[model samples]
Target: MGISRKKIYEEIADLIMQDIKDGVLNPGDQLPSITRMAEHYQVSSASIREALNTLSVMDVIEVKHGQGSYIKERMPLGFEHEFQIITRKDIENLLDLRKIIEVGCVELACSHADEEDLGRMQDALGKMRTAVMNNELGEQADYEFHMAIAQSTGNQMLVDLLGDVSEKMLETMKETRRIWLYEEKKSIQKIFDEHQAIYRAIAEKDSGNATGAMMRHLEEVATVLLKQHK
Candidate 1:
């Protein structure tokens, strides 16, 4: 029964990919409503959602919390192999890398961030607030906030490095947020607050506080995510 259910969702994912290839769904196109797709595919909503999640993790679709999922600008190369091999350990390693990179980033930002940098981070916060109100994941805004911190460091090399792996970072955020929201039953407001704390510490130019906040935020997410695998 489990094997059959998994096959169904994978078939649905393949069908959606075919639609994209056929130009039935174009880049930046919002997918049909889940309910609509469920009825059309004669599958449960859970199965439809699983298919969408699979595509989203594969970088084939972008899932917004309140907004519907949309086709990505480009499909990832070698996604099938990635879908097969992605594991909890991969997520754990990613979270560890973030702790190493981002905690130091916020500390540097406390020293170098100008008003313009703060403005960008604040702008991201505002967008996150709107997303929370709308009951969305706010993943894009969350990504922007972290990028803004990297930018605030005035380190072009670091910015470029993060940009190169931006796709993976965004995917990690989506996965952890899903775990936090759906699996852990966390409130969106609480999640937003973690980012807010990091922002506040940087804005205040307190390196000690900024690093602590960033570390805590990443660690909290890591604990929640890793716990699930156990």
Candidate 2:
């Protein structure tokens, strides 16, 4: 039997999700127009619109009346409940998935990133440093650093997905950090050092080192979370 309209919409959603998973559709990048998408998917424009609406409610994308549909910034970590029912297990899964995806993204970014992209990453890192030194909210800065790397991959979907994932993780980390209070200053310093390592690996165009650095950072984060739960 032929596919139904509902099935078509579902497929469209899956396509968008896959793009995010593969790092093709980046955050902040405008989605192709309904007409364009319809032509690409060989579906009715109405179906495409419906799929886009669903993504919008999920905070996966934002449709600004006139400007067009763009990916939304990542939601702050603890704010997942505001949009969806994200459980602790979900958070753990997200962390694992992020570890795998981010490692690849860093490796790709090291090879693909240009001077302008590197400059942007350095700028984000500088913000993180300032935030840590001033005892301000560094979560955003940290988020930016990762997002910048995702951007460097020249993949819009990957950038958007990572931004969304990181945003939620950052919120979770903020709450966890507050509860643990394990040498706040020292912990912050460790984070800075870890970020520096990732940055250096990317700067040197060493994909292997970048992946390794990312893994170490994620491992440290996971270790902390595990200890807190125990």
Candidate 3:
């Protein structure tokens, strides 16, 4: 008989719980960023995010926009209980939420993003191009650039929501990125093209055009990710 183990994220969550019990992470202290947690755990950011999400849902920790996750000042009741493992379906739903929220984010960004925000988006894109050219995963740069767009909306809630969505897509993004950059040996120029279109629309303050570009870009990416999983 085979022994069934906890999901990776569940295991990660339990480790956090242990840290809590050991007084390693004190109340009101911010946890490490998701990327750092992933590195520490030798796991994907998706797993770390899922673990954090479980804690957040349980009211044990707080996920604040812009700032990292934090230990709640007051521990929620039943903090000793086990967390339900996040499954593939949960990730899919998170992605779906991203699609819905980000399209709206781009629209709001068109009207709200200032010169500095747009410039930062451009800078992030440059970093992404550099990462891709060097044959690196570029996942960090990619996530940053996308998060910049969400931040541009000036809606903290939307920014926070998309931040969670970014992690859920991490694994799928890696697979599709490999297929696009290595297996097929295709230029990721299309990615730049789509991002450029979206950026230009936002810079021009063309809400309608920005929304359309974002929709098309995300829809195509979603299709590619789904195909890879299939």
Candidate 4:
């Protein structure tokens, strides 16, 4: 049988992980750009992004907005077992729930967000735009953007609820975002544009538009990711 794309990416992730272990890629070292890595590995940019996504989620790397991927300051002590347990089904379920929760969050933000809240969202989006311009992944800024919206609700319970799931949600975000950005062949600019649209709606206090934009962003990521899994 032909090699599956999933297996190919997993192997690429493993190779990078091994490089870390062998001191070839030391802690805090910035990795080559996805384009360069793809050229070296003779793989597609999507595969490189998948490998980086897995590493980021595993705590083996940190993807900083406006900068490239870096080896973590401290590697995860025990991530292999946990990583193995997270199936595509788990991500799909989480995306379904994220759509429900975050769309509501954005609607509330549109209704109640203050200037400070809008400023925070705008800051996150700015970082995301810079990351895109530099050909970097804006995973952390993406999380902050959504969290800022949740905080704008002025509902502590909702904020706490999302904070409780922050770890898993982070991993889910990295996966879904990479799939949408690279696997779906969507541009990084598109990701920033989608978030910008949501921010604009909230800034204008348009609850209907805010929720609709948020839903579309989440659903597009989910749709592309699930389609790849199939």
Query: What are the TM-scores, per candidate, against the unseen true structure?
Result: 0.64, 0.59, 0.58, 0.65
- Distance from true position, residue 83, model 2, in Å? 15
- Which residue pairs show backbone clashes in model 3? none
Root-mean-square deviation of candidate 3 = 12.8
Candidate 3 per-residue lDDT over residues 140-164, each given as its tens digit: 6667777888888888998887766
Candidate 1 colliding pairs: 65-137, 66-136
- Candidate 4 lDDT, tens digit per residue, 169-203? 77666655655444446777888999999999999
Pick out the ten consecutive residues of candidate 4 with the lowest summed lDDT: 76-85
Estimate candidate 1's alpha-carbon lDDT, on a 0 to 1 scale.
0.79
lDDT of 1 by residue, 33-113 (tens): 999998888888998898888677556799999999999876543222223334567767878778888887898999999
Error of 1 at 64 (Å): 15
Judged by lDDT, which candidate is best? 1
The alpha-carbon lDDT assigned to residue 27 of candidate 2 equals 60
Q: lDDT (0-100) at residue 116 of candidate 3?
A: 82
Q: Which 10-residue window of candidate 2 scores lowest in summed lDDT?
A: 75-84
Instruction: Give me the runs in candidate 3 sitting further than 4 Å from their true place.
Output: 1-88, 183-186
Off by over 4 Å in 4: 1-83, 228-230
Residue 32: error of model 4 in Å? 16
Per-model lDDT: 0.79, 0.73, 0.71, 0.78
